[model samples]
Target: MPKLNIFVGTMYGGALDVAEQVKPLFEQAGFDVTIFEQPMLEDLIQHKTDVALFCVSTTGSGDFPGNFVPFVRAFHEQGPALSELRYGLIALGDSSYGETFCGAGRALDALLEDHGATRLGERLEIDAMETFMADDEAVPWVEQWIDSQQLKAA
Candidate 1:
């Protein structure tokens, strides 16, 4: 079985809530799972996991939550190539923000792709403006995502 590592960035905790909710599902799918909140670049670079999951929220004006700013900078400025990585991303934001909605997630997703990381599937974007409760909407979406990948949840 492969490992699944979950990382999240959030303001007011919405993205963190979604990460916690999905952790066990990955574990049940026979992955050795680890979760991080506003992780450092070293935290991601050191791990040799088969899959990395990101749940990140866009903060004011599309900025990354304060805790994640350093990680984002390091990812763009100093992170190593990640050709062996496979990933999934969950972008949490209010559609009312228009162009900036989920900007942090999109930025990270592009960063990873640029470094040669492959996506497990399409990124999941939860619209807080539409759902009111982002985490609630994320649960089934994640389950279906795992299923769509044809991954066995042992």
Candidate 2:
């Protein structure tokens, strides 16, 4: 089975909830899914993750959540090459924040790309001002993502 790591970054649990909501979907699609509430760079390297999903919520002034800060710092400092990694991103933020909306997710996307990771599809950006539940948007997107990637049970 293909292994999939879901990295979650949240301040008020929205991103975590989104991750939980989508876990079973990935499993149903034949992916061995793991959700990391507090992600670490070592988790990626040690587990040899090839495919991943990032569910992150932008905090104050577009800052990363406290739990996610360490992973971001480690990734930036260590600068591991991720040419073999494929990823999808879900960014939660209120659009009212303007340019800073989903800032953390956008930054992470760029960072991952810079490190040679391939993005499987377009990033999902959930606007808090419009969606009451992020999963509503995330679930459909994930389903499509799985289909687009042609993921099947091993």
Query: Which candidate ranks first by lDDT, i.e. highest?
Result: 2
Query: RMSD of model 2, in Å?
Result: 0.9
lDDT of 1 by residue, 64-130 (tens): 8988888888887896888988889999888898999888889888989989999998998999878
Clashing pairs in 2: none
Model 1: how far residue 60 lies from native, Å:
1.2
lDDT of 2 by residue, 16-134 (tens): 99999999998898888899998999987788665899999999999999999999999989999999999999999999999999999999999999999999989999999999999
Q: What is the clash count of model 2?
A: 0
lDDT of 1 at 154: 73
Q: How accurate locally, in lDDT, is each candidate?
A: 0.86, 0.93
Highest TM-score scorer: 2
Question: What C-alpha lDDT, on a 0 to 100 scale, does residue 74 get in candidate 1?
Answer: 89
**Candidate 1 colliding pairs:** none
Off by over 4 Å in 2: none
By summed lDDT, the worst window of 10 consecutive residues in model 2 runs over 42-51
Error of 1 at 94 (Å): 1.0
